[model samples]
Target: MTAITADAIAFRAARDHLLTHRGDPAKVGASFRWPRLTQFNWALDHFDRLAREDGDAPALWIVNEGAGEQKISYARMAARSNQVANWLRGLGVRRGDRMLLMLGNEVALWETMLAAFKLGAVVIPASALLTPADLRDRIERGHVRHVVAGEAHAPKFESVAGDYTRIVVGAAQPGWTAFDASRAGSDAFTPDGPTQATDPLLLYFTSGTTSKPKLVLHTHQSYPVGHLSTMFWIGLKPGDIHMNISSPGWAKHAWSCFFAPWNAGACIFMHNVARFAAPSLLETMARCQVNTLCAPPTVWRMLIQEDLAAWRGKLALREVIGAGEPLNPEIIEQVKTSWGLTLRDGYGQTETTAIIGNAPGLPVKPGSMGLPMPGYRIALLDAEGREADEGEVCLKLDDVPGEAPGGHPGTGRPLGLMAGYEDSPERTAEVMHGGYYRTGDVAQRDAQGYYTFVGRADDVFKASDYRISPFELESALIEHAAVVEVAVVPSPDPVRLAVPKAFIILTQGSAADRTMALDVLAFARQALAPYKRVRRIEFVTELPKTISGKIRRVELRQLEISRRERGTRDAGEYFEEDFPDLKS
Candidate 1:
């Protein structure tokens, strides 16, 4: 515990300094440093400290849509997690064992996460939305030794034969252990030993929009301590009610739900909805008094479709932001006009914490992902691996900001960075090559260092010798009244080598007819540069997306290539040449 005590002191100094100069980016940048840690157990050392400070203060507050609700205090959560840890240890959940956790938004989810942290076991978080087929891949590929899932999903694993222990939450199942039995365990737990900061804590399966899902590895230090930067970026403060709308499986869930809010000593607020509806979300926010809010661009886009003026001044929400996708300028402006709150944008991945974000009190530049965060040293490198104004967004793992670029990890490698891909060292080396962690997502950096999202390297295309960004065109298309959502991909063209084609989702009242296609094409033509104009359009009820809501542009591109090769005309497809006025 000596290492934990010392680690806590160092960690708090960095956290308190950020909190002290919360508004001044210059002061925060100049003073902030990642705490050097060797041995740290976040649940045992840090969370327990907060519980001691406020025995009765609310730590977790949950409200289901228009129904039952629950609140757990810091003391109660600490004690309950300790009991769960003891019970898990009794069931032979030893240190370093991988546990598959699949549950919806519930109290047990939080308790199980903390208990696993305390016990030094690795957790592989899975979305409840995952089918039995999906679960098979995780259990086999993840080398799962234990499983904690809702009772309803227990039958899914009936055919998945394995030597893993099964623990159920809701009701008694045939072979699974009931989580309720843990409540009878004593509210006391002592760890077998100190947790090394490098010990594996989380193994995440990436959403895999581009390819097969890769196993992402995070250490105890990577998330628990690393989220301090996230806390500062979100402008979280002690006792603040932070509600981030995210699913249970993804990295963003842990980024906002588990580690970031708790790192700031803020209360975790959750509103479970059977289905996400904008009007109901606003009504609940008004009733719950949520202070700081974070949601994906999809939710924000949907929320804007509601008469935002009627929902204005409903809640006490102060700091609002969007992540998981690039927040379009139109959505940000709508929220600002209605709620008088700028919906800030942040950029990170399953492999890292918030690397670049529009930190609090900073100017929100339209279409820019603010400056790099305190702990990260960002470098935009071109395809040739040379420094460029626009290229792949990379983290300087060789050094932190305010230091020379090529320093060793001891001098400063970001604590927020993941350990590596679990079983794929070759893939890890590919990303961590040249002393930088390459985020596959590309971007353009302005002179002021604000990074604007370019399409993914695979998503960017050349048409008529001019480079075009799908995100740029998609951003413009979404602004049109008839366009609810859109994905821009290259369509085959004999003249220009390739042309931008938009697959669009129409709004509720809009039709998927020729007139609507002409309207959208005309809208895009007026908004885009001559070379970047969308030449083709198609209407679809929905775009193929990962469960996490990221449009698989890769899939869309494949469909276009196949259609072109097979000479099969896609139904509901419309081209600029089809409309005489638009062609002109």
Candidate 2:
């Protein structure tokens, strides 16, 4: 198929179809088709056309910290991006060149991204939170040919050596070119060549939660087209203002904050801040008329700490969703009660877009991560690879026999799936075996097909011949007023072979002393099953987390193993010999 057909196949015209059916999976899946084209560029095709026709319409709305807000029209954005594309092309940026975009959620960030897409350049978006070491890894591993960053961040890359072209967005440096100069260039964007649907568009060096970060490669169609499910999941409507609480350079950032919302012709709202302040975010949301909102569980957790009812914005806001981590049912309920809004939960990864999500109008099953999106055939596979009611979540590519409807057909396979990790074919093969992509997460499905997340494949352990899910135990523990955040890991025990242990982070008013620990322990005993009781307890000040805000259970597991090896014992560790007060 030609590149235009590929582009058309990628964007499958699901907006109208999805809206008509609205969360009706059977109809949506049957109707959805990836947008197919012979020669197409989103920036040149969709973005520019939207700008030309809807020039007065607001495309981006950014609120700076307490100072003021700036709104840019779709027309301005189209022209600006075209100028940047032309300027970058003049600076040796070619169709296949890789560039690192390290900047805040500024206008230029979006502009550069659109420009990069137009140029068919592979953009590796880097967060300002990344250290020099992280930058080094991305620079060396990503094969970046150009670097686009704010002037303030230039010093961060000062020591990192690369032959890539440097383009600064804010202020001009001695060696870097100012992004402002792009305005002098022509608004007419003339692509040197067509961008194939298989063309590499973006590279993401993921924030490694389990292992070293892998460079996640996305095709021109992967994210831009894949996020249609995300658009449906969030229930974003045309002319709506959507604000997603995500830091720049992350996959989730792009998921809700960019393509998904834009695909529906919604205004993308950004509230730039150094740290998360609950009241401030709410205030901004209200002030800016945010119609739909998406945030990770971390931000949602912090938001719940404050009185949620105190702030109600004037926006015709309808949808709110949570990702990043599993949404605690309690948090979801709290938000629902306070805001009269239900928090939808979605599950996906850096490798793909939102696959399973509680789409709008779907009856959310409390803690369940809703049904699979239309065009996705999600299956629970047992250890032997046969279908099961509860096991690993795997996609049945064979059953589909092809990509989902509206999925790339002659375009070859699914459009939403990744192009594989750059230079890591072995790892790619591991996950994409048996014509199925194993999610590595285990889950149980009900008769109705609603799936509930069990835990990471490695996080699940057995004790006393009873399989245990850490999430279940942790959920039960957090119900106690004293517990703020908790992690459950297996502690070696000679009696049961292994036992559940609680690593607790107490609430603000809760103490870390023995009294508080005992209180939490007692609460856990009452809340959890007898077999899954916390046999040991540790009061930790904070839990180790990946940059993405996921708790590093692997690190916690290592700590437990190290403690076992050192033979340094703690009070909560159950020991028959030491516990003279306990009767056998």
Candidate 3:
């Protein structure tokens, strides 16, 4: 056995402090401290130690319908990951090498992540849904040396044409190594040397909600240890079954699935289906006794479309959370009404862990994403870089004494922040400038410290003299019975300079004609203020979205601009002037 390291001790002390004072917010904020570690290997020090202690306790539970369920214990996970690490080492997977993991929600996905950590190899998470072009970009730009994916996704890489090592999970692919071979390898692994706390560990590609994706970098202590705040936010406890509905590639998947839940010694419950049927998923959670859940807003919206009352009281959820995007107040209210549990909203980005979230015992305001979590100092900076009630949400890095209100926070960076954008210092400097990490997303902090989300910096527009927020308008539009999904963009106007226009998806088997548009426009008019009312409505079969499910408003805006430039009108567009019935 190895002697207990200083890094492990510090990590444990910080985690224990949060657990102890999980109730008193003031006490936690005043006394809590971010751990300062010189050397750390989370896979070796934390996960392995817990595995040895927890023994047969469930660490990962995957629910599969016809294939039966797979329940892996902590001890088995440690052994399996150790075997994978040894096999990877034998195949020339060295420290600092980048390995892209593209697989479904399977045991091998978790196994490969732990193995990469043990081997000191940097991991780049990739969704299996990537196209051939995306794969080429990841391989060339990410500098991938190895790829671990399911055999089904192997064909997509055939045309990618890289000099990387190919390893398949299910079956032996043509000219690829089989991951099953690792089972016969040694189950005991050893590190070559000590790992620095700041060593690169993960490289994530942002979901590109408004623009092209950027590579986000994290270190050994950033995500795995930094998610203590996320653990604190979720109020995760030992023996709890946390079911987080996130895809494998995104950063949220690692935030909740790999680190936060495991840090609390809770079992990660994952459900896999060929097609997502929320009713069936609710039944699984009910039957298996899920203790907590964190799902994206889109999933929550879809779940509510069904008969939510049928499985209302049957759920075993103690904590329900909304993640990924800013959730509408309507969704939160509907869930609260049905399940008798407040669906709390959490705000964060790929650059950091839970910077601000609604921790337990905090007063949650409707349409607000709660307060700044422990270890985070939030400042809303306006266009002039001055603090404001509503502005770009920036994190205070250091505290400059005798300075102004928006002065630098401090010298040392928080443990939760990413190292920087990989190989893109210019882009890194842009966001990390002025002693603050600009989150790009904006919000408004109330007098009581509750923060309500505004639209993204690039998504907010102006109509007449008043500033317009697409999120606020869309939030109100979704409350209408005929609306399924909607995206608000600015339409060029000579009078108001611009007016709010909507690209809407109606309910299934519903009309998209003048009557449907007028009904939606009337409902929105009643809900929103005069200046904020949607002036034009256009029916669309589908809204353009990033693979992560965020609406591509930038594209929608450009489309409108081009249409006006070419002097062409969309046949689907319905203006308020044409619908005299909606004129009030």
Give per-residue CA lDDT, model 2, range 321-388, as digits (tens): 88887888888898888888889998888888888888888888877998887656787889999989
lDDT of 2 at 558: 87
| Candidate 3 lDDT, 1-584, residue by residue in tens | 76679889999888888887885344476677788888999999999988888868899999987789999999999999999999999999999999999998899999999999999999999987789999899889899999999999999998998889999999789999999999988998999999999999999888787656899999999999889889989989888999999888989999999999988889999999888888888889999999899998878988888777778778788999999877888898888788878888788888899988888777677778888777787899999999999999998876556665323222246779999999689999999988799999889988888888888999999998888989899989988877878899999987888899999988888988888888888888999999998998899989888877788899999999898778777888988888766665
Candidate 1 residue runs with Cα over 4 Å from true position? 1-4, 24-27, 400-411
Q: How would the candidate models be sorted by TM-score, starting from the highest?
A: 1, 3, 2
Root-mean-square deviation of candidate 1: 2.0
Residue 382 shift from truth in candidate 2, angstroms? 1.4
Which lDDT values do the candidates have, in the order given?
Answer: 0.88, 0.80, 0.88
Quote the lDDT for 238 in model 2: 78
Worst 10 residues of 3 by lDDT: 403-412
Model 3 RMSD in Å is: 2.4
Return the clash pairs for model 3, or none.
Answer: 398-409, 398-410, 399-409, 399-410
Per-model TM-score, in order, reads 0.97, 0.93, 0.96
